[model samples]
Target: MNLYQNDDTTIQIDALNMLKLKKNILLKGPTGSGKTKLAETLRHELDRPMHSINCSVDLDAESLLGFKTIEIKGGESVITFVEGPVIQAMKQGHLLYIDEINMAKPETLPILNGVLDFRRTITNPFTGEVITADDNFAVIAAINVGYVGTLPMNEALKNRFVVIDMDYISGETLKNVIRTQTLLEDETLIEQLGKFNKDLITMAEQGQISEEASSIRALLDLCDLTTIMPVERAVKRAIVDKLEDDREQQAIINAMELTF
Candidate 1:
């Protein structure tokens, strides 16, 4: 859990405090701020089984609760119950992580209200079974603000969980994270990419770019590509190409020119 940042006592303490409360948590942050990574780390630290769902527009009650699938055995057709992540997590006392929860359809989230509040059970309308939540079961969701296709979470859903505001890890910790991920010791390249990422973030914040800010993941991609290609080309393919806007792409090219 401390693998990414050896000395990030702030997040370490915050994570522990959140777990101590044993309440549902919602992590709000900018894209690529390591929100999902934090949730995974919490599950690891707590030693709980983890079930993750990447929330999307298509995810709905049937997809989450359970669905019936037909199975054929010995030429006879039989119906089998297939469990979804949420229910499986509740029954098995695991951590159910909903990544990018705001991307999910509005109708899909009301199911979480009961699971988060004093009412600790979920009913399967399809199966007519009341599934009581286990004490060891918990939920943690991650959301990024201002992302296109994101929905404004309803008030009832917002009231259910204690929210944690997150941002990118500190500069020193980011270097450590890059080192941990790439096992490379090129400090100059590392620093340049970090600064470039910061600049992109600033530009995005200032409404100068419609693309997502460069992330640590993008740096990792650059690291991988540089072993096989030139730094300039790798910067384009692994980082700049992620932006579809021509203007943003040119901006990234200019940034790479200044960095590399």
Candidate 2:
């Protein structure tokens, strides 16, 4: 979480400046644009405890709040309280990160609505206590635009947050990532990979390709593994293989062919 501007000339983030905002901000961008990483960096700078939940189509209110659990202690059935990430965040005053918030079921919005408003409290069904949010509790949700099959967040829930449309990462940032993450420190290769990934991202933006567009994560993961294995094999497994067989995958493979 402690990420400094490793190179002042390249990295754009000033975590201290971001943590100073009064309201919770929704970070919107395309895939692999460093949204989560930025959140982690800011969390460290603010010295805030974090509780994150990755939202998918299946997430529901019960998933957001605490649930009932049965435990066997001394051969006796002991009913225990099991809290979800949201409830835990509320209790600890941690920075709650809901990754891909838009992907959560529409029904879940009502639960979030209560938490987001000034009457910030969550009711634990088991405990029967309407717990209030700690003064320091902050929500940082990340979302993607133009992803098919994702449920659009309801207007009411959206109204609660300050939306910040995030820009695609600059070439220099990619270079910095490459230099730090990849095994080959050759400035030429680092810049080359950055440009290649940038081109892939562009193709995805233009709707010229299918699997989720190449991410900063894809390049970083590739770089991290390439030192221990062949780059081609690493990319094949770490990226191409992970993607579903879709138009995006073809476009990405085509771009890779052109680049390397």
Q: Residues 189-218, candidate 1: write the lDDT tens digits.
A: 778777877777777667766535455567
lDDT of 2 by residue, 203-236 (tens): 7677675425577777778767766776567667
The candidate that achieves the highest lDDT relative to the unseen native structure: 1
The candidate that achieves the highest TM-score relative to the unseen native structure: 1
**Segments in model 2 whose C-alpha atoms lie over 4 Å from true places:** 1-22, 73-75, 181-184, 211-213, 244-254
Cα deviation in Å at residue 37, candidate 2? 1.9
Candidate 1 lDDT (Cα, whole model)?
0.78
> Which run of 10 residues does model 1 get worst, by summed lDDT?
1-10
User: Residue pairs in steric clash, candidate 1?
Assistant: none
Please report, in order, the local distance difference test score of every candidate based on alpha carbons.
0.78, 0.73
lDDT of 2 at 222: 74
Off by over 4 Å in 1: 1-9, 211-213
